[model samples]
Target: MDIQVVHRPGNSAAKLTLDAGESVTAEAGAMIAMSADVGITTTTHKRGSGSLTKTVKRWFAGESLFLNHFESRRAGSEVWLGTPLPGDMTSMTLQRESLIVQGGSFVACESGVEVGVGWQGFRTLLSGESLFWVKLQGTGKVLLNSFGAIYEQPVDGELIVDTGHIVAFNETLQFTLTKAGGSWLHSILGGEGLVCKFRGKGTVWCQSNNQRSFGTALTPTLRARSR
Candidate 1:
């Protein structure tokens, strides 16, 4: 199977070329296009009670609990995948490197990768953010989508990022979500908002824009009709 991310830097998508019998599992609703020989199957993995609970958590986190599998019925079958948001697309080749991604960052992944929920604590809850994130482990290429241009921040000691700007990070890093200032009033007024304090040597990916801020900006115009 061959996967390529094209039209990069903005408005990008993944074009996958699959050999006969090859298949890939993608986040539901990610398929934008495909060739005639490509076949699709949807599964919720409802075989176990444990997975059902996990599925519930994922649903609360703003993600579809089911995965769509695309297979090539004939040689050189092609399929295209994209995110709902307009932004940059990138792929990572993982070999046992666990990845924890913000909600809605995932697009697609090849076989051998396991997707699940990870790392939701009190700090995260206090920030009024989603309680869970998508976690990827095992070995395979995983596609990540961002709300805007994505930047890779290498952290050796400490790094702080606006909570809404985070995309994905490696398991090697430890992070805590907290208010940006010493006092609640200052935190609320300073425009610093919630921030994630990260430590240890690893990498963190952040988006140039914040989704909450974007939504907040639109709320006024959207609600004008109501007034």
Candidate 2:
């Protein structure tokens, strides 16, 4: 399947054109204009003013409905929407047949699909295993965005990632938040405090800039605020 990102970065509307039967998932309300024959479906959820209208238009045009809100379909493949890069959607995991989201909600392709919080809900229906899973249902390409440049680090054993710069990670890695440096006094005085310590074998994706601290440091009176 072929894919093209039509809109440039920072534009109000980012449009993706997919070949027939190719599918892509995106945040709930990002639809601008999709081809009628392309097939679009999502999990069930509440709709704001123009959401339903635009979705219906795409649906009637020949897009097949999958699970609502959480999943979608076109002809040959499916799309799983990632959290909005610039917005407040949280991280998620998909395991086996279930979709698991942390601090957010999910909709299924089939109607009346059970939706709930915590990891147990997904385990009960999909499998008994206690792991996070994110499934890319289709063969088509998908476009993802980030607030800044993303860097990949190959870890053979352990690595520490700054929480603010974390983009995503493989489910195989275990992590915990802890104080950086050797001692509390050092962390406080040196200005680098908490960090995420990751263990096990996997990859860590980090962004070039910290979304929170950078904004604060960028403002005027930066020297006074750093204290």
Point to the candidate with the largest lDDT.
Answer: 1
* Tens-digit lDDT track of model 1 for 1-227: 68898877678889988878878888899999999768888876422223776777777767888878888888888989987887888888889889998888888777778778875876777676667898888898889999888889999999998888888999999987777889979998997778899999999998888777888888968746554
Q: How much is the lDDT of residue 192 in candidate 2? A: 62
Q: TM-scores of all models? A: 0.92, 0.51
The 0-to-1 C-alpha lDDT of every candidate, in the order given, reads 0.83, 0.41
* Clash tally for model 1: 0
| Candidate 1 to truth, TM | 0.92
**How well does candidate 1 score on lDDT at residue 196?**
93
Q: After superposition, which runs of candidate 2 have C-alpha atoms over 4 Å from their true positions?
A: 1-22, 36-143, 218-227
Total clashing residue pairs per candidate?
0, 21
Error of 2 at 163 (Å): 0.3
